[model samples]
Target: MAFNPPPKMTAMAAAAGTYKANLSALQLLMRGLYGGAYIAIGAALCTVCSTGVAAHLGPGIGKLIGGAVFPVGLIAIVITGVELFTGDCMLVPLAAMMKKINFGMVLKNWICVYIGNLIGSIWYAYLMAVGPLVSGHADGMLAVNAFGITAINIAVAKTLTYKAVGAAGMWSCFMKAIGCNFLVNIAILLAICADNVVGKFFGIWFPIMAFVSSGFEHCVANMYFLPAGIFLNHWHPETTARIGGLLQHFGGLTWGDMWLWNELPATIGNIFGGFFFIGAMYYFFYRKEVPKG
Candidate 1:
């Protein structure tokens, strides 16, 4: 069979969760780092592909292009068995609900994975800022290429624009993040349902495409996106100064602003979206149906 029934899938998720919890601290962090870098690869691809696309096509079509390509990272993670914090937000908790792991274990995994993801994301962001984004120019001579400018626009939109909106912006970011992980966890579940490689590919692809096209916020991806932009601001101030449109709103983006406005709120929202909306809901609904060990 190419698919598992709902109850069977639920049981598999619990088992997978248990396995994740059993991993040693070093194992979890290492896998988490891989996962983060993988996600950054997809994000960077999206930025590069979508740059200047809106002018050629339309805004909606450009977003669709980005969304279509963004799932490569998650597909790689799922197939290769790396740890992603957003995915863990659901998986570890589902294990706890199944009585296969404890809350402490869940917290430990979350902390380790989150830290690993941050380190990995920032490392990749530096590579991107200095490498492809700037075309390997020296620090002082760095000129923001089109892709680099696009990255700055993204970071500024995610952070400063939200900061400008005050409480409403924070709430908006939270809601978008919630929507993002909700679809992401569903994609994970769908991947679990498939029994073959092709099945898994399609299962992971569509939901991810939808979330990105819908303009939802994803914290793991943003860890790279925001820092890449911040690095550009510092390395290519002249390039930023030349841009006008939305760049005017982004006076000076600080690391603190990145965390305060976007990443922190997005992380909180992702936890709820994955843990409660998908993980807990699916666990409870299928609990009675899950087979006994």
Candidate 2:
């Protein structure tokens, strides 16, 4: 497969940004829903596949397994033409910088897509809570399974651990969020560079795997991950007793904790990371070379 050169790829990225800028609020919202659901599918897969992997293989291997499967969501989004908020953080801003769209349009896109993504993520979380995360017993009651426990553990780690250390913890989460989008935009750039399906697949895969394996924070993914755990914990309050660490220390996951601890900081950091770190930097490097419309 052929690869586009850097200058050409830069143009392609900007062009993509312009295309997204023209989408209607309803279109953006509907696509955003799909984007959120697709990412949840990947997150659920990672949770289920990585169960007990740390015990048998190792923690590193466990992370690798989760990371490897997690890219499927982004892959689906890219192939199916859905709107993902994290990706739009770069794409929409890049178009504005290129003068193809205005700041107002960019803000509109972000607002609609962000809301859509949150709704979609929560919707998937409900499905998991009622489905694979639970098991039916002889009594016809469903109980949280090992995967559900893992989800709760992940949620607590993402939220309470950061809450534990105060400002320092928030700063840590912010920095991780920055790192995550830096790689995420890089994956998008690579996808734009590739001319074929296989090329785009591999292009998008590695950086995403690296981000997930390295434990960087992603706002949209957390939208799903945090809620799924919260749902499980709410339905199976006994699971709270099962979790020994930050979950118990914090009195379990709450919506406020989810936003205050991880989501809010993560969203801000993601904007900076994707907008400035990737979008602005790329525009600065390629502005003169970008083709005039």
Candidate 3:
């Protein structure tokens, strides 16, 4: 029966937020690097584990499998105390609401952590592109496998599908991004509520699994997913060409498309969802009852 009450959890979150907001840029960046890499680990695992699952089990179950594995990253981030932009969107803002930090501090944490996350995500993406996603032949050539195809398809679906519909596409991506952070911060809160490892693990797992299974957009995950696809395409054009009309129909996966279609909007939406929906609302509901310092 051990659990923090809602007000206590809010206060604890605010305190954690304050601590995170005050971290040195180096600390924030380094932790964020770990955060990003950990998330990429989950993302990569999800991609590999769920490969061909849909063909066998149906898309719904494939998504569930992928979602099931994706929480490992967030669990690592929360348990190890690393900065993740999506989580920070809620945490730092909560601290600000409690008057424990300023907006400047919140912005600082977000910016540094975001850059670190992008760096870590892309770095892992590079590893995946050159490593497991491709196999080298005796003749010094490389080709992508089923997992590689899945990565490319993911990248295309995240970006080109949005671009194809123009404004409406962007809107859909934005809405999905909002849902993503809403669940993400909720996972963070649930993690805070738990008093032990097993409690925290399951607490973190469900919401994260739900978000990924629901096909929500997450900016940090996309940092890895999109670039992994881009790197794969660059490493193996023949494989990229195999994706066929999706490539041509959506104008292919370029850096511009990666940012314009997914990353940019997702980031903005994550901030809105995490901050307004979770951080602000929680503060509003629990502020007066939070024990005074």
Candidate 4:
């Protein structure tokens, strides 16, 4: 629980290093796309599964199930390939400004990665909703079918209550969210700079655990998880009277209600949380000499 600030880059060093990542424009674009796809998928799975555990087993056990495992996606996002818009967009420009990279190049990286991430999320969301893999399991309370019933589970809804306490209006709520996500980005980057796996895992775990425990919103995850779960949950009909319980047992309001109320605000929070507040603030403080990590 001690909080350590992420290392800073000096303005002169930031300008001098200017390593072009050795990746060409096309490569950078692909890296961005890949990073976005991985992160989006990771977020969706972590959220849906974690929330499902909570809903089925009760809060304590759910938290334990969600907490105990390491999501290797964190490593995948970094090692498996790609410049995550959530992270690289934040770091690259800072590096360029610090003299570690060129401003135009970093901006190019940000634009390509950000757009690619959006496309990937939309694709992932669509597949998750209409895919045959889920349709087969939706018919039965099948074990292999967890993803079918899991879209809207306790994962995000409880997070709503947690957020409402913070949402004293957007500014206060987003302020808290920004601080939390800032720390998360720092932890993630530091983990990468770490020399060993244990160092890396602990580095990643610290921020991730805090973000989860504190219940901050991750925008991209919401993009995939919320929509996917809601779409799957919508198969039920209140008019049929048999209603498949999407209306009543889906905690009364159904997935649609959860999306409108919870997802929207949380997303706004995530943007304010990770991008504007955290990213922008760090950019402001950036000395422009050291590498971001």
Model 1 quality (TM-score): 0.96
Candidate number with the higher TM-score (3 or 4): 3
What TM value does model 3 have? 0.98
Q: After TM-score superposition, what is the CA distance of residue 261 in candidate 3 from its true location, in Å?
A: 0.1
Cα displacement (angstroms), candidate 1, residue 24, comes to: 1.2
Q: Which candidate would rank higher by lDDT, 2 or 4?
A: 2
lDDT of model 2 at position 231:
95
Tens digit of lDDT per residue, candidate 3, span 140-201?
Answer: 88889889999999999899988888999999999999999999999999999999988899
Model 4 spans with C-alpha error above 4 angstroms? 1-29, 55-57, 67-70, 100-107, 130-147, 154-180, 233-293
TM-score of model number 2: 0.98
Residue 174 displacement (Å), model 4: 3.4
Q: Runs in model 3 with CA error above 4 Å?
A: none
lDDT of 2 by residue, 130-188 (tens): 99999999998999999988888889889999999999999999999999999999999
| TM accuracy, model 4 | 0.65
For model 1, the run of ten residues with the poorest summed lDDT: 240-249
Question: How far is each candidate from the true structure, as Cα RMSD in Å?
Answer: 1.7, 0.9, 1.0, 6.2
After TM-score superposition, the amount by which residue 103's alpha carbon in candidate 4 deviates from its true location, in angstroms, is 5.3
lDDT ranking of the models: 3, 2, 1, 4
Residue 275, candidate 4: Cα error in Å is 5.8
